[model samples]
Target: MFKNGVFYYYTVLSILFCLLSCNSDSSKPFEDFFNTTVSTEKELGYAVEIEKIALDHIESSSYIGEIGYLKDNIAFVDYRFCWVFLFDYEGNLIDKKIGHGKGPNELFIGRISGFSFLSNGQSLFHEASNRVFVFDNNWKKIKETRINWKGSQKYGKARNIKRPSAKEPIIYSPDFGNLKFKNFNKKCYFPIYSEHSNFNGLMGGYKYYKEGRILAELDLSNYSDINILRLLGRRTPELLNYSYLPHHSTFNFDIDSKGFFYIAHEIDSLIYVYDHDFNIKYAFGVEGENMDTNYKELKKHDVKKFRELFFNDRPKRGYYSDIKVFESNDQNLLVFRSYRKSISSAYDGLQIYKNKKLIVDTEVPKGFEVKYYKNGFYYSNGTIEEEEEKISFYKLKLYHSVF
Candidate 1:
C-alpha cells in the first residue's frame, strides 16, 4: 500500500512540474517580445545615385504593367498602345508588336497589369479582362487564359450589393502580381472594393485557372477584411481621421512558393504572426496609443482637432507600405519599403527593411516616385518634358549587411 501511495504521489508531482514548466513565462522577456528601441540614427536617410539610360521616344504617360528582364538581356515593357515592346538592356527598343486587338470578345486597348517570365522561357502578361496572355520569346502570342476571380458573390455582398454590372465588372489592377512568390501558378488574386461603404476599402480574392477553365476559387474575404482595415489605416491618414481609434493594426499577408498563405495581424499595434493554418507563432510591435487620456476631451465641434491628435499620437514616421520575403544567402529576408518626410517636403525619402530592421534609405531626387524591385529599387521622376516625353530610371545600390 505504501509503495502504491508513493508511486501515485510521484506521478502527481511529475504532472504538477510539467504544468509549471509549460506555463512558465519567466524565460520570455517582455522586451524580447516587444521592440522598444527608438533610434534616430538607425532611422533611414535618403541618398541618390543617378545613371541615365537612353530612350529615343518613350511616351510620357504613366505605365501600369511590369518591366520583365529575360535571360538574354531583353527587357519587355508594356506600352499604353495595346502593345508590348521588347528592348535591350541599353534602353534601345528592339521590337514592338500588338499584344491584343479589339474584337467581338477580345480586349480593346486594355492596360497590362503584370508581366512575368515563365519557367519555360515564355512570358505571361495579365490584362484587364482577368486574362493572362502567354507569349514566346519573339513577342508572339502563344496562348491566352482568363484568370479566375474567386468569391465574387462574397466580395459583392460585403459591399451590400450583388455582382458588379457588365460595364463595371469590378476591374482589377495589376498590383495583384505584387504579391511576392517564387513560382506563380496560372492564378491571379484580385482586390474587390465596396462602393457602398462610407470608407474606401477592398478585399482580396483569388481565382485559379488551369488550361482554359477556372479550376478552383478561394475566398479570402475574412482574411482580406482583417487585412484591409490594417492596410487602410496604415497608408492613408484620411481613413484614420474617420475612425479616430487609438489602436492601429498591421497585417503581413504573404504567399509561399506552394501558394500557402502567411498572415501577421497587428492588433492594437501589437503584432500577431500566423501561418497558413491560422496558428499563432510569434508577435512584435508597440501597443496602441491611449486615445482617451492622451487627447483633450472636447465635444463634437472639435472633430478635426480630435483627428489630428489621434493620428499624431501614433509613430507617424515608421509606417511601412509593403513587405515581401525573398531568399538571400539561403536565409529568407523580409523586404519592405517605407516613406519618410524630407526636410523640404512630406513623404520624400524611401526606406528599405529586411528581417524587421531598416537596411537602406534611397533619397528622392526633388520629385520622384521610388518603387521596390527584386534586386534593387527603381526611382522615377514623374515629370515628362513635352519635347522629350521620356521617362528616367534610377537604380539604388543596397548595402547587404543591413538585413
Candidate 2:
C-alpha cells in the first residue's frame, strides 16, 4: 500500500511539472516545430542577363528614392531628398528642377516615399504620411489634401510628436519602392504607419500588436476620405518568438495587371493575395533555404534593448524583403526577394513564381531586384557609387527553356 501511494504521488508531480514547462514556453506555436526551407529544383537552370545604363548628367546623392514612370519614354528618379532627376528611355537628361522649397512648384519637405502616375496627366506622391500631393505633368504642385484616417495622429512637426523613448525609431514605414504605391481604376494605395507601431511591436502581449494595420487607400473620387486596409501583420507565429524590429515588421505590396494585390510581410513567408476590394482571396509563398529564426526575444517593453538587438543581431539575419509581380510575354511572374543575412555577402533569395507556381527558387545577386520590366526585359538599378558620377542599372532577362 505504501509503495503504491508513493508512485501515485510522483506521477501527479510529474504532470504538474510538464504543465508548467509548457506554459512558460508558450511563445512557440505549432508551426515553430517545423523549420521549413526551400531550394530550387535540381532540373531548373537560371541566368541573369546583365545590362548597364549610363547617365549623361551629374548625379547627386547615392540615396535613390522611388522611381516614377510618366510615359513609355519618360521616367524620373527621386534623387535624394532635394531633387527629382527626369530622364527619357534613351537616358537623356530632361530636367533637374523641382525640389524642397517654399515656392509654388516646390515642397516644404520633398521626400518621395512612394509615387503613382495618374492617367489624367497628374502625379501622386506619398511621403509615408497621411497627406497626398498631386501635381501636373509639368511638376507643379496642384493640391495637397490630408487623408481622413481616424485614430491617426497628425505628424505635423518632429519636435512636437512624442516618442516612446529617446534614440528609438521616430516612425516605422514600409512603403519604399514604386511597387508599393499602387493605382487601380479610381483608387490608389500607399503604405502608412501604425501609430507607434515600433513600440507596440515590442509589446507582443498587447492587443494592438496582434491587430496592427499597415496599408491605406486614397479614393480619387473622394480624395479626403481614405480607408485603412485590414490588419496586415497579424501575429505571424514565428515572429512571436523573437523581438520584432520595426523594420522586420514592415511589408511591401504590389498589384498585378489582373488587379490582384499581393502583400509580403518582412517576417512571413506567406504572400497574401487580395482582390480589388481588398478581400483576402488567398495566400501563397516559399521560404528561403537556411533562413534564420532564432532571434532574441524581448519580453519586456524596453526600447533600448530592442534597439540594441536590432543593431547588433538584425544585420546577420535573413528575412523576407518585398514582393513584386509583373507580366512578361503573356506569362505572369511573381518574385519575392529576401535578404541572405550574411553581412559581408551579396546573395539575396529570389523566388520566381510563374502563374502562381514557383519555377525558380534560386539565389541571385544581392539587391538584384526587378526595377522595371519593359519589352521582354527587366531593369534594376546597379549599386550606386558615391564617387562615380554616372548612375548604372542592370537589365535582367530570365531564360525559361531549361525549366
Candidate 3:
C-alpha cells in the first residue's frame, strides 16, 4: 500500500512538468521562425577536392599564425620566425621583413598576435608587448603606436582592432571579454555591454559587419539561451536587438552578407537559417546522420562523475566544438568541428549551399585548422613534421558538385 502511494505521487509530478513545458512561450518563437524546410532525403548537389600547396620555404622552427590575402594575389602569412611573410601566388617567398625588436623598422617585441588588413597596401598588428604596429605591402614597418590603457581598463590588454563601418574614425578592440571602441582622441565601452553586465562573457568570436550589424559569440554559463548578442551602432549600440533561446545545447552562428544568420546546434545534425529580425527562414539537416550519438553516451554516465570530469579535467564524450560560415557571391559555406569520443583529434565537416539546396557534405582533412576562405579555396595551418619543429600551411581548392 505504501509503494503504490509513492508511485502515484511521482506520476502526478511528471504530468505537471510536461504541461508546463508544452505551454511555454519559448516554444512559439521556434515554430513561427521557420518559413520553409528542406528535406535531407534529397541528394547532395556539390563535390569537393582539396589540392595541397606546400610552403616548403618556411622554416621548420617558425609557427604560422593566420593567413591574409590581398586582391593582387599576395598572401600575408604570419610566421613566428618573428616576422610576417609575404608570398606570391605561386607559393614563392617574395619579401619577409617585419622584424622583431624594439628599434625602428622592426615589429614590436613578443609573438605576432594577429594581422589586420587596412585599405590599399597597409596592415596592422598588435603584439604581446601591447603595442600596435603598422606595415605596408612591401613588408615595411610604417608606424608603431602605444595603446593608452587608462582608468579601470588597464587590467586587460587590447588584442585586435575592428575598423569602423561608418564615417566615424572609431575602432573596436576585444579587451579581455568586453568590447572597447576608440579613436585617436578618446575611448569608451560598448553601451549594451555597459548596461547588461552578465552578457560579458569571455568573448570567443565577433564580427562587425556593414551598417553597424554586430554579432558577438560569448562563453557564458547562464541559461539555455543562445550565447549570442546582436547589436547595432558604433559609439552606442542602441539599434535592433534580439536573442534566441538555445533550448538544448550551446551552438555557433554566423551572419552573411545579406544579414541572414546560419546556426547549428552541437548535438543535432539540423542547421537553421534566420533572418535579421530573428525569424527562422528555413531549416535542413543531414540525412541518416546521427550528430547526437556521443551526447546520448554522456547521459548513460553518472551525473556526478560527469560533472567532476568536465570541471576538473575534461569531459568523457565527444561534442561539437565550433561552427563557421562563409558567404561568397554565388554560394554559402558552413563548417563545423566535432571532438571524437576517446580520441584526441577532431572531425571537421564542410557543407555548401546554393540556390536554397544542400550541395556539399565533405570532410576537411585531418590536422589542418581551416581559418578563412578566399576566392574558391580555403586556408589552413598544420605541422608537416611530428617533432613539432616544422609547420606547413595549405590552400584547399573546392570542386563544384554535379549531383
Please name the candidate that would achieve the greatest TM-score relative to the true structure: 2
At residue 103, candidate 2 shows an lDDT of 88
Error of 3 at 27 (Å): 21
Clashing pairs in 2: none
In model 2, the runs with Cα more than 4 Å from the true position are 1-46, 57-64, 73-76, 79-81, 119-121, 128-130, 151-179, 196-199, 223-235, 243-247, 290-293, 328-333, 336-338, 387-390, 401-403
RMSD of 2: 12.6
Give Cα distance to truth, residue 21, candidate 2, Å.
Answer: 40
User: What C-alpha lDDT do the candidate models reach, one value each?
Assistant: 0.39, 0.58, 0.44
Summing lDDT over every window of 10 consecutive residues in candidate 2, give the lowest-scoring window: 164-173
Task: Show how many residue pairs clash in every candidate, following the order shown.
Answer: 1, 0, 4
- State which candidate, 1 or 3, has the greater TM-score: 3
Model 1 per-residue lDDT at 171: 28
Query: Model 1 over residues 58-173: C-alpha lDDT tens digits?
Result: 44334434444555443435435455555655567666655446543233546766555654566656555656666666666666655444333444453554433212223222
Quote model 2's TM-score.
Answer: 0.72
lDDT of 3 by residue, 51-142 (tens): 67655455533554545566554444453546656676556776666566676677546566555554345665655454666667776776
